[model samples]
Target: MDVFEAIKSRRTTNGYFLDKPLSDEHIKILLQSASYAPSHFNSQPWRFVLIRDKARREHLGKIAGRSMREVMAKGNFWKRYLKYFRFSKEETDKSGDGIHIDNMPAVLKPFIKYLFSEKGGEMMNKLRVPYLLAIDSKKLVSRSPLILGVLLTKDEYKKDDLSGMYSLLALGMAIENIWLAATALGIGVQFISLPMEAGGAYWQECIDMVQPPENYELIALFRFGYIDPNAKRPTIDWSSTQRKPVSEFCYEETFGNKWIPKE
Candidate 1:
């Protein structure tokens, strides 16, 4: 696929991937693509560690699952993240972001609306039933073929410095490059995001498994593999993810002065 086409079609795969390993050549291409992202002062402060070992991936999955479950057990899930969930189709259609209930599995869709409700959230928290979802997510992680860890190194420039901000932007560019490259190759990728929110100890354990360079911090984790046609995935109205017209966020030299695009 062409670059623009890949960019337009790229979407995060929801927890379902075929049990196939990516070829060495394809992997190299993705890494090379990531490396080409523009960096400030050419200080590419990002390092990638690819884990292909099944056992290690499984172990990491367990850590992610367990950590996620623990968070749910703390009864703060609704206050923490679920509040951001837009459950109704109407709500999803109106907003440009946040997860939609339609993208959820049929079995869980009914529960989602209630789970996000005030009384429902309180009751579920008391019951602590969401932990089961975490268990299944852990299995999904274990089955993934490739687990990639992205580490951010200590910048020569401090966090308060412009150089540090540039480095972060560059890292985002690098990740987008890899995602588009994988899309072009018909590979799917989904983030292993729980560890980051779980806590420092959980996050540290995840980084330790990858054995990254000293002082480098884990910034992101993801699993990539072929799509499993039979796997049930969250139902998403992809059109909702489309960007709003330029007039919405663009300006003509000053804020609030909208810049209209040529027809």
Candidate 2:
């Protein structure tokens, strides 16, 4: 696939992937793509743990579900990410940014905003939205054909050192390489983030399962598989394809200066 086209078409797959394992050849390409990413002075601080075991995926799935439930129930999800939510076409169109909450059960349509607010925890719990999300999270992770555990070496990931920032930037590029490669291969990727977001025993369990060495830290987890065209959408779903125009964000060298591109 053309690089530009692959980048434009890349998407976060929310529904189930085809119930098939990834070929060893494709897995090699994915890892190889990451390895080729440029790092600061070629420090190459990233490491990956690929999880394809059935029982292990199931256990991680349960932890993800429980973490999602706890985070939403405790209002942490809302407190942190409410700014990135768009409830209607009007809002989404106006912002041209942020994820649009375009799909949900009819019961949530009326109170979607409130139900996602910190103050609505009691009412949301009554409706069991968190429980529903938990089930969805569990099923999604468990059904995935692969779970990628991304890690960074502690030697290069020092928070106070200049190499710390360099390692993080390098890893971001590596992940982007993985994403673009997956898009070219007709695979889909989505972050398995609830455990990280919840940040407690749930997160520790993930660390234990990934079993990173003491010198490395597990930084992120992502589920991967071929896209399932006939897969159904979740009870609560969102889309973030909308993006702000370059003019809306780019500047003419100096900050706040307007930038206009030629047609």
Residue-level lDDT tens digits of model 1 in 66-141:
8877776565655566645776657765665566645545555557667666557555555455566576668778
Per-residue lDDT of 1-263 in model 2, one digit per residue for the tens? Answer: 99999999999998889999999999899999999999999989999999999999999899999998999888878778888888888888899988888898898889989987768889889999899999999999998999999999999999999999999999999999999999999899999899999997989999999888899999999999998889899878999888888889999989999797888
Compute the lDDT for candidate 1.
0.77
Error of 1 at 244 (Å): 2.8
Runs in model 1 deviating more than 4 A are 75-78, 103-111, 126-129, 234-242
TM-score for candidate 1, residues paired by index: 0.88
Q: lDDT for each of the candidates?
A: 0.77, 0.92
* Candidate 2 lDDT: 0.92
For candidate 2, the per-residue lDDT at 119 reads 81
Query: Largest TM-score belongs to which candidate?
Result: 2
lDDT for 95 in candidate 1 is: 60
Which stretches in model 2 have alpha-carbon errors above 4 Å?
Answer: none
